[model samples]
Target: MERTYSVLVFGNEENDIMLILKFTDQKFQSLSDFLNSEVHNFYTHIQKELEAVVTGQKEESDFGGNMLNIDIGKEETEVYYQMDDESLGEPCFISTDELYKLVLEWKEMEEKMRRGEDIFPVILED
Candidate 1:
């Protein structure tokens, strides 16, 4: 089955920080599964690079050299990324620390949801 996903980047350039939130297609078995897998993939990739930097095998500056590339289904996926010109850096340049924080926040939200907590507030439609 084909699945869709969304990658949202939220932050300001003045602070040079961005938070990335990836939502898995609801068509999947469970949100937990999807989130777990996605987080695992990200962790694996980042861990490798982090280890390299720790071991002096790679330069710290090269850690987040590549742009954030997420694969989404053609018809089902949607992406939202916006940045003000005043922001100092591009979305592609989000730091590893920010990415790590995003993952942590994602996991925390998932846990809260599992406990039957509502993470999103109700929105009134016009």
Candidate 2:
């Protein structure tokens, strides 16, 4: 019924929900730009991504797991994202750059996990 969008900015500190926006725009750059623009289409943006994932030709996504899995092709621009199931909150968009970095980091972490190195939290330490 309404528009909504979510921005998932990786935080180094705790106690931050990042910024989630919901609105419509004639000119919106990156998702960051859309969120930074104002506090507005929290649903519209999310539905957009959902449509891509849910209604896409692939019909399957590697969102979360033990390994790093993300691929955004030309026909289908995919990226990692998440939303709180309990919170019923807005969906967060994982920027392409961040997604790539996360994938690489997660791959390394997964390898370490397989080797039985340091496997505890799935946090990408900067």
Candidate 3:
């Protein structure tokens, strides 16, 4: 028997990507340890990107109430929101309309990842 984790990169149904990391007890522990150490930094970057897109700012900021990373024992996962409303400044705003826009943006991002492009260090232009 073996245990594995599935990494699903959610974009649009048209082009969804996933990575499956299968590791032995030893390797899983090793990888898990490493990811846990880097989870915070990874989350920070996600938060920064969210801020940039939502606020139209080039600089990064703390992720006030966004759920960027989730830690599960020896594994971590990433989640993105279409609107960081708190940062975007309007708690009363309902942004269901933004879902389609985010889908397209995420689709493009997924394509880049398919090309083995570096996830961070690249900012999208408006």
Candidate 4:
């Protein structure tokens, strides 16, 4: 199946950070609530988890309120996403290199947003 991933970043009056993930037909998003100062911690934890996954130390990892499930393998990482009950798409297998690049892109986007810079969202397709 044709697979695509998109990240949508929004900067509003409240400095909202929304990272939208589109996997095939399903749509999942990571909404950051910066009020409690948890965004940094969230990204840090996710990066560590992703590293563990890539190093064969973790088999699976969950992100964003169980919206995504990542299964790590020797060559590719399978990602399953669900948005509510209406949208549940097929799993997408992303290569290790692609996954790592995507994570870095996300982190960079988040950093830009935090620095009060006007930014645009990035989309990934494979």
Candidate 1 — number of clashing residue pairs?
Answer: 2
All candidates: CA RMSD in angstroms? 16.2, 14.2, 15.7, 6.4
* Model 2 lDDT, residue 33, Cα: 32
Residues 2-74, model 2: lDDT tens digits: 2233334366544332433333432212332323322122333333333455445444343332211234432
Query: Model 4, 1-126: lDDT tens per residue?
Result: 123323344665565554443434332222212101222446676566667767778766645423554555546765555444424445566665566556665566666656756544444555
The model with the greater lDDT, 2 or 3, is 3
lDDT of 4 at 9: 44
Per-candidate clashes, comma-separated: 2, 15, 0, 0
Best first by lDDT, ranked: 4, 1, 3, 2
Q: Candidate 4 clashing pairs? A: none
Off by over 4 Å in 1: 1-37, 40-91, 122-126
TM-score, each model?
0.32, 0.30, 0.24, 0.55
Candidate 4's TM-score reads: 0.55
Of candidate 2, the 10-residue stretch with the lowest lDDT total is 32-41
Per-candidate Cα lDDT values, in order, are 0.36, 0.35, 0.36, 0.50
Question: Of the candidates numbered 2 and 4, which has the greater lDDT value?
Answer: 4
The count of backbone overlaps in candidate 2 is: 15
Candidate 1 has a TM-score of 0.32
